[model samples]
Target: MWQIILKRENEISLSRQLFYAMKDMILEGQIRSGEALPSSRGLAKDMSISRSTVNEAYDMLETEGYIVTHQGAPTRVKEGLYLEKHQKHHEEALFPVITLADKPYKVDFKTGQPDVSLFPRYVWNQMMYKSFEQLSDKDLGYFGTAGYESLRVEISHWLFRKRGLSAKPQDIFITSGTTQALSILVTMLSKAGLPFAVEDPCHRGLLEVIENSGNSILGISVDQEGMKTALLEAHDFSAVYVTPSHQFPLGSILTAERRIELIRLARQKKFYIIEDDYDSEFRYVGASVTPLYSMDKEQVLYTGSFSKTLYPALRIGFVILPPKLHSEWMYLRKHLDVQNPIVEQAALAEFLNQRKLDKYIQQISRMYEKKRKALTTSIYECFGEQCSILGDETGLHLVLKIPGAHFDEFFIEKCQNAGIRVFPIEHYCISKGNHMDQLMLGYGHLKVEEIQKSVSRLYNLIMDTE
Candidate 1:
């Protein structure tokens, strides 16, 4: 008798279990070629299973070519099925586990992360539940390739009230986030073999997305007023990506004149512009700058996201495309992800309609403003005249420019070894050595006390290095 066992009580069916056992045996050479399988009735009696179970298992094995059966003859295992085990050197490589202590720093100045502790979870949860309960049958189904019409309407209103940018709901397309929106734009706008221009020390993630899509990228130099439009004029590109509201990492708002120049260039060159209006909702100073999209909706593609404002996991963002490009965007979006989750879209629309987003931004903006002040104060107390903080006016992070200090690979490794996680601006630069003296610090996630400690630690580390 074959050593076949079946457990009818297991989650897997008896037939599947039997098939697996038999297949394993055949593969291991236990059941050799031309070996006769026990007749179904006999095998079932021996294994204490129904005869039909055994028959089903045998039928599956035969159907899969694992075994061949001839009428009134043995079931033979397929020939040439055994795979020889190859002998090779197996080396266990030990990689160094990077710990914060290895760098030994008191303060971490990473940027872009928001303080999750400050989020109004209770209110958001209530909205989420309410929206879920009110969802219609049609809402559960694919609404449209564009987005939830209600959410689009609300976003249009939200942008106008918050950022002073007026956009039509018809022109808006929802995406997972700004990253996905930018990614789709890169694919949608890049003419055959044409290059897209981006800021030199731009957001590294956006740069990677454009490059990975096989689109050419021209890096334009960025000064205090954002991307030098003069540099852009000299270059020929299909599209130009700019952060007009507030430049990332460096924190410079694109000036009005340059904005006009960029729009003019795009119109003249027959190219498009991608305006990433991220983090502009948290501006503490002058009025939130008007998005470049307002200047010329025809040629500019404006992208915004809720990750920084609401929460990162929400994964809700949108793009404002011109009327001409709407059809192509819808086509690409249909194939990309089909559509975003309707529940969140419906909930977010309600949230905006109730003006909760405006209140939330006002609340977080105040909190962030305090954190930014604390960070600047801490840096001044520790570093004295030795260091200067850059771009402290806007955004969640600032650049600490230490004079005569070159933060190269050796310095970065040294900081990591000390438990301090600070990013060198050079790490973000496409062409290095230009920003070697600057370190990017994000204070949005750090408490006022943590900021003080981190700054003190960084100061001591810098002094020791000198």
Candidate 2:
């Protein structure tokens, strides 16, 4: 007699369950090779199930090579189906739990993160709903890699109005984010084994993108005036990447003179300049700085992302390419994930067309500016004049420099143990030993009270270490 148990109460189809049970028995050697299985009619009668259900299970077993069946012939177990049971490995259970603290960190100064809670959910939901309703059948299909045409057009218009830059819709290519845009640009522009020049204390993630492409990177140091353009002439470069509007960690605007000098060098050396205009939308100071792409469109690959402006989950960003590079860009983009999803793109296009994004940016900028002030005020109050703040004029984070204080891994780890999280400027440096006295603190996502308390905690931690 067969020992097959059926679970009629289970939600799974009877055929599937029977199939799994039979397959397991075959693998476990309970059902020997070449052994004939029970007839479909007899098994159905014995189990009180339909003959078709038993037939379906047998069909699946035969299809998977667990059993073999032929016209008017017995269904026999396939040969060599047995497999040894794997022993359970519980090695991970032997490890001790190392607790930093009982509770979560008092503060986390994570950079490049915006306050997503303040986003207009209702309005955005409305845009998404409308987009879903209005999208033609063709829109839901594989749209072009160049991106939603209407969204591109709206982005072009918004750029002119917001940043005073002129970009054509045809030349704009949508990407998942600035990260993806940078990765593709690095791969495309890397030439003949020539290195890509980048700011020394650059965004580590962006640096990795260039490094992963198998191209050498030339780390040009940055200062209070941004990347040292004078050092760029020492070697031949395929392309140069710079954050011109507001530098990443140090937060310095690329002065007009330095911008011109960099462009001149690129022209003379026949290299392209990748201008990453990330997080310039929330500038709390004077009018936003002019992008380098506006200066020389032919040689500058301008990239921007809405992750900081809107929400990080939006995953919508763009790069402005010259006519010569458009074909290659499409070819590369096609190979990399084919294209981003269509619903989000359509919703974003509608959102841009209605100027909802402009309104949201205006609303959030005021709040972020206030948060920035709270952070600066707290830093000044905590360490007084001993700690000076840098790059507070714009962006969600600022550099806090303590003249004699060295912020390293040990200091950061100690702070983390005390339930506080802060990053060192040196963490982002390509060449170590520089920016040892500076710590990077992001405040755009923190409340005023949290900023004050976190700064106080940070102050105590620093004093205790000293």
Per-candidate TM-scores read 0.88, 0.93
Per-residue lDDT of candidate 1, residues 1-466 (tens digit): 5576778789999999999999888877788766777888988888888999989999999888888888878667888566544344332234444576534445566677788887778877888899989888888888798999999999999888887888999999999999899888888888877788888788889888988998877888788999999987676887899988778778888999999999898889999999998888887777677788888989888998998888888999999988899989989999999999988898899999999888888888899998888889988998789889877777788899988998888888888888888888888787777988888988887887677777888888888887
- Worst ten in a row by lDDT for model 1: 85-94
Which model scores highest in lDDT? 2
Instruction: Give the poorly placed runs of model 1, Cα more than 4 Å off.
Output: 1-15, 25-35, 40-107
Q: Summarize candidate 2's per-residue lDDT along 212-245 as a digit string, tens digits.
A: 8888888999998999999987899889999988
Looking at model 2, report the run of 10 residues with the lowest lDDT sum.
87-96
> TM-score of model 2 relative to the true fold?
0.93
RMSD of each: 3.9, 3.2
